[model samples]
Target: MTVEDPLFATPSSEDIERTMDILGENGVSLVHLQFSDIAGGGRTVSIPTALLPRVFRRGFRFDGSAMSGGMRQVEVDLFLMPDPSTLVVLPPLPDRPRRAFIYCWVTRRGGQPFAGDPRTILQKQLNRASAIGLDYRVGIELEFYLYKGESLATASFESPHVSPSYFSDSDVGTALVRDHIVAWTHELGLGVHGAHHETGPGQQEIDLRHLGGIRIADQLNSTRQLIRVIAEQHNMKVTFMAKPFDDAPGSGMHLFQRLLKLDDGTDLLRGEDGADISAIAGHMIAGQIRHASAMSAILNTTVNSYKRLADGHRAPAWATWARVSESSLLRVPSTPEGTLTDIELRSPDPMANPYLAIAVALGAAVDGIEQKLDPPGAFDENLVHYNEEEFARFGVEQLPQTLGEAITNLTHDDTMREILGHFIVDQLLTVKRAEWDAYRRHVSPWEHIQYGEL
Candidate 1:
């Protein structure tokens, strides 16, 4: 079914009226119709109040090729249909008034869902789960670093701690930015489970409640945007960079995934009779571990991402699963019997695209179910000791060590390339290669200091 005509029941007339009332009450001057490109970057075109109804009924059309990795030049004309349920009063800038934001899905001219669209990719994964009589529930854990001021350059790594504990008084600059982020996140209708000051001086994390992938992905993208906006308001800066500062911990995009079967709405990962996990749960983890090497390019894409992949930085240098270990690539959380049991993919960095991240993860899990794969033995000791020989024996392989190697792995893996499609794969390679070329030419302080006098 098309996104506009969801197989599920539509929102009631009363709900529509209430949404209109809310929009009017909020004094929203314009509506920002937003959708994600294939790279999971936000792209939008604003419409004034007078044009919203007409556009809402007929939807809006634009050239699909203009969107990065969306479509080829020959096949253009993408359509956008907004979700009324997603209407929210957008947080305004210093000089701007309130505006509403509605998430949209892209489609072809005849109203078919665009295959190259990242959102559609995720929707297909969700639909596939439905076909198997399973429902997927996801929760995202967002980690980010807060910087001193609104600038591209990072603070020196040697700086002392300027931020306090979550509840304690922080330095003036950090406290002001954190408060703004927390307040605006709540104001934007995000169900922020909690916000806290991380261990590092300028690091922070916000936990979000469990929700479906569609909305949660939207929230993830918007949350990143919110951090920057709110930080700017306080004259500070925020980064989702995986490894911005050389010596500090990097940000991660951790997802908790659970499956519920439609037959009787039972959590598939839980066992009713015993303490052991369900067979299906074991298989799912197995799939993730099996595909972990191929999936690394998507999970940890940026050049700096590998900087955080070293031992002791909380980056999973090894491909392993665990029931309770937070350091594993896939963590199966321990929960009470009869409650939802989930496996968390912990390798994704904050810089990864939310839609692509979710798509790869869900696709891997679904593969697990279809193949009936069983997870390998779990590890209690640290995984960093596994060298190439040991990793091969354990069926574990080190992730790509550099962006160049990552691109090669991603391009060569037929499964990942087939799943992601050529458009996305090619575009990602082109973009990242350019970034590498630019970075390779740079003479950084590390290089200068190490070689200048010697």
Candidate 2:
């Protein structure tokens, strides 16, 4: 029993109609429409080419039972309204079928956005920025590890240098795989600034160029999917879990952001008066710092993620900012005169739902701008090596040490509940709390080893 609202007009009618002509001419018979579940997991629905016009003009409906993650008390029909702009001629892959697919906006039967939808949630926050004549362009640096073949988190190796700038003869096979991946990335119109080996064994970093609005989040999802397909083709496996191996450096998804004038495309952070630091930029930083801990539950998103956020892991261990410190939660890497964007948020791991992550961040930033919040004095040094005593002396606060802690922080932040709907927030609490409870109940090998001696 589902119905489309009369006002729920299909998006970009002309563009989709035109694209379908090309798709039909190219002999494309199937399309996979993709959307994110509440946790940012990618889900898809395959539609025949014949249904393209109807699906685009109306929407695709599916049972909510499978993908809802228990958010709904009863199974209901959910609609996916495809984003025509994301229609891509997906090149054939060995494992996947030859088809074109588009990302989508999740909606309810009445044509209203589903409250738990990540993309819709993000769009709401961005709309807040848009209302004020502001916009954000985001650049993503995602790190993941390549394992030998079908490996588990327990696997470990002797390691490479704790450096990202070096690549050796040992990187040949991985490099070739990455080369093919990068080529396909370009083919799909997801351009990359760089792809290279990172500090840990078989770790790699791929930097996606800055994109505006929901497009970057959509592309981030596509890129992660692409990485897996490419890895499987080469008989290698990849892990985006923040810390898979205890001994190795944790992987992170560093976000670089800039505020822009929506109409004129001016870099507002540079300021009208051309001050060294704009009030907007300071407030943005202050806003992000204010919300960092609560946002961690969404950005980090896993029990293993906290391990990556630990000290000495080249990840942000504390809620701190610096002009250029790599180890702080927020780092402004450049200035108004510099060639690069100034603000980089370093705490998010690859496990996060990019949509929710960016939404909370942007929401917090918008709050900062609205409140005219002032940032604290900067903590200029690399705090990765700093102990708690040193942190107190410098007045920096540590991020949550565990998933449980992160959940607690999230509960206290009404801003997160307000920004991300209560439906999503409550769903996360239900799921993550269960996970933490299960972890607490389970017995590990360490317990056996220690208690056996006792």
Candidate 3:
């Protein structure tokens, strides 16, 4: 029983011993073996701390059929082998039992990797990049909303205006939540750049410093869980829904990505002039733009996701790139002298599986570089406000307008299907199509009000 992927390198006996020592010293009573499903949902199976040594050697087995995404009842047995590097001790919060968490690699009973596992899918993509002498760094700007409960109408913190309330000190609730998140993130060893209030009422954003692809994905997943736990502690509810309210701005999980050379840690996207973007960067952006429509399926991932892409919400709705406009799908920020340059992809919501979303994205960029695709001219203006003639003149086109449309694009695109294998793509399409069908059949209040009387 051997598994040999650089991303899933088996933990050495010494390394496992050291981690066990830390858990024992911290009085950790439970260990959470966590993994993500194909639909971006987190699933976990907890084990008593006494089984740590057995887990390190043989791994824990679970029923895969009970989980969302792939395995059926006939092929249900799967194993979770913990990754030692991802171990994080729970903060000593009052009334909460001491526990440690670690992410795991999904494998079959015989120790072969599970292709249907979202984390494994991501690692395969990373392996492809590594084979080419390249690696990637990712930073996330995650926006979410705090509400009283299931009611979207009641914000936890009330504000009247829609103007950008970047960091107003007047809201005590927001301040407390933000501070707690920052502190807890720091305690968990996930570097936090900052947190602040966003434009929508009760909306907030957290910026994480850049890290390697796998590490950042793990942190983002953990951060989402932690936010929910902290929100409950304060007797509030937090949602990463793309568009929680029709009239308010949508929350987005904006991704900042940069590619680097594996050998010397040099940024491959930085131009020699220090002021211009490198050719490789252009190709990457071009790749993103070319595949923007298909990529939306994974990036946005929900029926409600389309609601956030309305004309005036600051979300990017078109497949275009720009030098600095927030309205563009890809925004290339001005690189300060001697600083690294990166691209910001604005379509993803927090609902997506960070692992799969980033893997597909980087895979597309690699495709563009290999084919040497040239990008269109950068659109430096607000695309949402563009007229038909202007849009045609700029060669800009709107992204897929609905979940169905996005799925169609995803199914038809050979590149995306290749990056995410036929099996994974088939499973995703099946799940999303069912979701779309269910939504289509349901009648909403808006529909009832508009046409039910007729």
Candidate 4:
């Protein structure tokens, strides 16, 4: 069967031969078949290099029943179909085995696409956009923190540096390690616009140039792996957690999205005469806002993720759109050319599954267009600063304050349920509800300090 993905091209026999040759030249003895699990964690199946021929022809079988994120009903075997176009030789790291990585597609028995596969779920959404003669393009700003790995045992996130600086001095301990990361990112063909020190010590941000279709999701997964590998090489560690420290600014994966006409290469969100809000742009924004609460379950999955939403350090609390408010869920970012065509969503954390996150956003915008949804007017004033009386007048509402609340909102949103698929949704509800319950029952240090005295 033909792959429906916009970026997938069937690999020729010659392509397969060349990939094997390059692996030998790079001194690689293992091949890593990579795919993302439902919780956005990267899963890999490693095998010896001698088995490429059998892998290409018959595919490698694994027990999917044991691997699923608690959503399985029966034991079934799944196969990994490799994408040859993503071939790259990973750079050498300390005490690490050299391996060539190939991103794979999960298929059920007889080579049918697995409904629960994260990559398959995203591809379906891309096809939907293509059917309407439009393409979804996304640029992501990924934020993460670097820590001295040994300090993790103490429960204090110890950074290599001591202060918050926008751009750290070149002599910082993690500076050289950061350079190695950027070099390898370019080696993998994921173009880097730039990297810099963020507001918190040891926190760094990397921005990639935007791409269309499933490539963006693929890029995010690959990039995260590279970051972890490089950090381990230096005997350090990195985290993409949404809220790792209560005193520090949380790491968020901000999404900058645009829609383009499939045939003519025209940007559909392009505003007339540099106006902030275009007709279709307005509708897309409205549609996303209409489903914002439900979409939060996909964008911010963890219980700790909701802490950042309380918003004193540049995160959103209200589901409002604006030109420059950091506390608004969506912002119209200013560009060098003064074009406000792209929509910037600030809520998604680095921990989110890029496949599901992008799919939900694109699907919601498409719904907006089909339903002619009208978004409320954009506000310039900060949303977190608003009083309850002011919020009611603008028809504004707060986002889900906790994971349980967000999961409840998701169950009520039929549009998001349809977009994310019932199988995925069912698994998420069961998994997340349990997570919420676990967190509620666990006692904390603050709880002991307050109630123990009484």
TM-score of each: 0.89, 0.92, 0.96, 0.94
Over 223-295, each residue of candidate 3 has an lDDT whose tens digit, in order, gives 8889998988888889999998877889999899988998988888877765467898888988988999999
Task: Report the CA-based lDDT of candidate 3 relative to the real structure.
Answer: 0.85
Tens digit per residue, CA lDDT, model 4, 189-215: 876677888887678888877887578
Residue-level lDDT for 424 in candidate 2: 90
lDDT of each: 0.75, 0.81, 0.85, 0.81
- For residue 59, model 4's alpha carbon misses the true position, in angstroms, by 1.9
How much does candidate 2 score in TM-score? Answer: 0.92
> What is candidate 2's lDDT per residue for 311-335, written digit by digit as tens?
4766887888787678788887765
* Model 1, span 1-454: residue lDDT tens: 2334452233455655676777788777888888876555678888886566556556688888656744566558878777777776876566896788887777776566666677777777788888998888888888887766436364532135543544445555666676777788888787677777776667788877777878788888777777877776655667787877765777788898988886787888886577457888888888877777778777887778888776367678777887766668888778875578888888888878788888788888888889999888886566665567987887776777777777777777776776677767787878777877887788999888999999
| Pairs with backbone N, CA or C atoms under 3 Å apart (clashes), candidate 4 | none
Those runs of model 3 whose alpha carbons end farther than 4 Å from true positions after fitting are 5-7, 153-164
Candidate 3 displacement at residue 279 in angstroms: 0.6
- For model 1, give the RMSD to the true fold: 3.2
Best prediction by TM-score: 3
In what order do the candidates fall by TM-score, top score first? Answer: 3, 4, 2, 1
- Going through the candidates in the order shown, the clash numbers are 0, 0, 0, 0
